[model samples]
Target: MFRHKGKGRRYSHNLKLASILSGVAGLVNITGVLSVNSLTTNVTGHFAFFSEQLFLKNYEMALIYLLYILFFLSGAFISGLIIEWTTKYKPHSSYIIPLSIEIIIILFVGFSPDLIPGISQMIISSALLFAMGLQNALVTRVSQSVVRTTHLTGLFTDLGIELSLLFFHHQKARRKQINKSIFLKLMIILCFFLGGILGAFTYQHFQLKTLLIPVGLLLFALWYDRLLIRYYHIKRKLR
Candidate 1:
């Protein structure tokens, strides 16, 4: 049934994975946005544009931004569909499929940068955005939304809110809530910024080949998840 409970000690690993995934998302997004002038992960900016276009009666731009919103929603929807379809039968392996797909796309982008222009930069941007959304949604679901790896505006806001609450309201429940929220938000923000810096440097030096970094991170995540599953299985058997 994949029940999620936040026992302080138990959530550490999930938090770690969330931070790493957030960093990967940030790097990939910055790479795509800088290279193509299109956002690859978060859709907040797209939605804002859509709203402005609607107000200004710019139907053409509105429709374009609306498509971007749909694409992002489609990604999350597909990820959830994958999880729902597989979780009842093979719960442990569902995330691997999306992660694998993302890796392949990234590798293709790295190897054939010209494909972006040939297919139209918008299409390439949408593909990367979809992949990022899928990855972010999967991680968020797995962590029970206690962690979100993409979209830093909310994260930063949450961090500030939590910090303020921690000092203003020292009640146990308030303190605990603030602590957890702040920790997760700060971890995500820091990781994403670090990733952005690394991505910029890598792009400066290696250009498109910098895609390898995200690919490597995904592979590492897969390996780590597999190890955790194996360890849990062994412990269950011993018990």
Candidate 2:
């Protein structure tokens, strides 16, 4: 139900949606990290780090990190499976489905106070990971591979290198190239950090129930996408 590009007046709308999505990703990462001691974003790095730790005699820390990595991978695998299974019926999938599922899991954890210690955290982390994967994939697809909402490490690194090139190298073409990359990279970093701050505060004060904001954002994304689709159809008909 989403379009990669919007027409004329709606161009700005797409950018706004991307920003909101990035913010949601940030919030999820922050919440997951604080509550679960795991990262929902950038599981690949987590995997590599955990692997190294495992080899270095830090078994406890490695196990915990490994769990996070596995859960995140599980999430991505689930998303991929869903897409593969539905490809025949639906050519494209909306991120709202997985996001809704993630919210449901969060609510369940929030309401059931007893579910925290044992296997509940693992399950919740898995759900969060899956939601993040779905979100990242959706944005990548919708933006035609131009945007990523989760895991700002690479984004920050890219931004740094781009800025360095912009200042150090006097090549005008290279400067223009680096500036655009830096802008989007910075945007992702800021959105994630802002989301993280909000998430940390919410979780600290409210506990596991702080996912209402992200749920609301998902609903809004669905509604906004529908509205834009309808607007496009109407305009096309008029022409």
Candidate 3:
């Protein structure tokens, strides 16, 4: 799912990608809220908070909010840079660095909360935002922008537009494509919701350690993809 791009990609690949990554985003989103009372998956809310602070003349708080947005942007920038740079030499495994970085960040925040001062809020929130930014960029490039796992604002908008298109008459081919898109979007939303529920439930018992669930899922995705690649090569050789 992560390796293929353009015509090499397929509906099933995207479906699986959306399911796993969206779930990971959901877990991170909920865990961030529980840990620091901030939306870590996207900067939409942070922009509003920043503007509000500026309006109230709270420059210090506004600067903090601005930093939150910058952290998310930096994550995206660094992930994209790493992917582009590595794609030149290692196209198949270009995603590894960013994905691994994301996993490590979440694991570090979860495991060493007490080791770092102010881990409860600022640091944790910034780390998660950056991690999510990495994930969002990685997946966007992986799927050629066909999938977005971190936030639902755009998903809902796209879903609504596609649903309305269904009401209009169209060619059979276009209709089939639209149906596939709707299914993919719905899967992303459903998985994200499920992940959030699991994250919240686990947080009550495990606190910030709840992030381990998403990290485990991501690790499984990595392992599963590698296994699939080996199986494909073996089958080709046998043939």
Clashes of each: 0, 0, 0
Where is model 1 more than 4 Å wrong at Cα?
1-9, 51-61, 114-117, 171-177, 236-239
**TM-scores of all predicted structures:** 0.86, 0.77, 0.97
Model 3 TM-score? 0.97
Instruction: Record all residue pairs in model 3 with backbone atoms less than 3 Å apart, i.e. clashing.
Output: none
Per-residue lDDT of candidate 3, residues 1-239 (tens digit): 89888888999999999999999999999999987899999999999999999999999989999989999999999999999999999998899899999999999998866667555477888999999999999999999999999999999999999999998948999999999999999999999999999999999999889999999999999998898889989999999
Better of 1 and 2 by lDDT: 1
Per-candidate Cα lDDT values, in order, are: 0.77, 0.69, 0.94
lDDT of 3: 0.94
Q: What are the RMSD figures for all models against the true structure?
A: 3.0, 3.9, 1.1
Worst 10 residues of 2 by lDDT: 5-14
- Superposed model 2: Cα runs more than 4 Å off: 5-14, 52-64, 84-89, 92-96, 112-119, 168-178
List, residue by residue over 30-57, the lDDT tens digit for candidate 1.
7887777877788889989999999999
Q: Which regions of candidate 3 deviate over 4 angstroms? A: 117-120
Best of the two (1, 3) by lDDT: 3
Ranking by lDDT: 3, 1, 2
Error (Å) of candidate 3 at residue 143 is: 0.4
